[model samples]
Target: MAKRRTTPKELPDAVREAVDRTVQATRGSAVQTRERAQGAVDDLVDTVDDLVKGAEGRIVRGRRAAARAIDDVRPATNEDMRELKAELRRIGRRLEAIEERLPAKRPPTTRQGAKSGSGSAKPRAARSGSSAKPRSAKRGSSAG
Candidate 1:
């Protein structure tokens, strides 16, 4: 037998409101309700997609910038390596001091997830062995 197909998802509250607004906007206007509502919904979707794309682009640029900042480039001479190491060491101490002063980071837990108490199935469980360490942290710190 063929697998049963499910109906499409119910409209979210915001989308429902958008539909209502669209309906209201088009009501007694030159355009049909469904057509104008479709246009409004399409416009909203396009706007949201643009926002997401913009954020994604910013994230990509930020990641590239951060990668560039943290990456070690080959200098002309071994003498430059010494200066680089010293600078790295200074950065390490500064980071350490900052961490010491800052609050200890805890794993995030949704209230429902915490209430469920299913430790193995939690989002934080997935992140446990993930690479969220400071760059200068030793390999030994890896949970794996």
Candidate 2:
């Protein structure tokens, strides 16, 4: 485009003043835009730095959590195992002592006429009215 030539002296006072005001306004707007852009850059940098710190904190926490988990599942030392075994043996001895104090169980009784020479262990049922005693009489009492 060709530049229009005009002398400042020939221009009207109002037109010159209006042109100056527009120039000043444009310069002010440029300065404001630059400042706002710089502020946005600074804010963005600060946000990124905060994000990095948060991530580092999370990483540290994760490492600590992993260490705690390992400790929880770590194998018992020899001393610990020995102590556990000793405790179990002590408990077993106590249980055996208690069992020894209990009375022995009696074997089931058979019919009086059962042959001892037969050597069979099974019990035989007596007849309805035999010389052998009734089951209820030999045993203690009946539920019915």
Candidate 3:
């Protein structure tokens, strides 16, 4: 129920032209902002590309370092294995030599009095030097 009629304020033509100029300037600034954003994106892409290339170079260097490290240890590792094998052989030989120098085991002595049969063998004494009997006649033959 309240429809009031208001008086219209008059706007100047110069003020309207100034407002249009301000809007045009704002549009031009928007275009410049878009161009700046595009330039920033291009710079960022270049930085990313450089980072990838640098990382690839570092990876190549790391692989080369790993290969060099393996090569550096190869000779030493082989030498260590060889030395270990040689030491094992030396220990085995020393053990064999020790066993060879061990004294021989003798059989138990027999009782001459316990044998009453005629098929019994004679008992011989242990001597260091050769006997007065010749080598052939010593055992039984006359070939000496």
User: lDDT at 57 for candidate 2?
Assistant: 100
RMSD (Å) of each candidate, 1 decimal: 33.1, 15.6, 17.1
Q: Which candidate is the best by TM-score?
A: 2
Model 2 C-alpha lDDT per residue in residues 30-128, reported as the tens digit of each score: 999999999999999999999999999999999999999998999999998999999997996787688779898578766699887665554444423
- Write one digit per residue (lDDT tens) for candidate 3, span 1-144: 999976455556677899999999999999999999999999999999999999999999999999999988876677889999999979967876887798975875667786656433543432434456643354376342
* Candidate 1: residue 65 lDDT (0-100): 89
lDDT of 1 by residue, 1-144 (tens): 999987556657678899999887877474576778999999999999999999999999999988887665634477878889989989977987887899977876567546565556646635687756555476457564
Local distance difference test scores for all models? 0.77, 0.83, 0.78
Model 1's alpha-carbon lDDT is: 0.77
Clashes of 3: 0
Candidate 3 regions with alpha-carbon error over 4 angstroms: 1-12, 75-144
Winner of 1 and 2 under TM-score? 2
106 Cα displacement, candidate 3 (Å)? 57
Strongest candidate by lDDT? 2
Steric collisions counted per model: 0, 0, 0
Off by over 4 Å in 1: 1-31, 72-144
Candidate 3 local Cα displacement, residue 110, angstroms: 70
Worst 10 residues of 1 by lDDT: 117-126
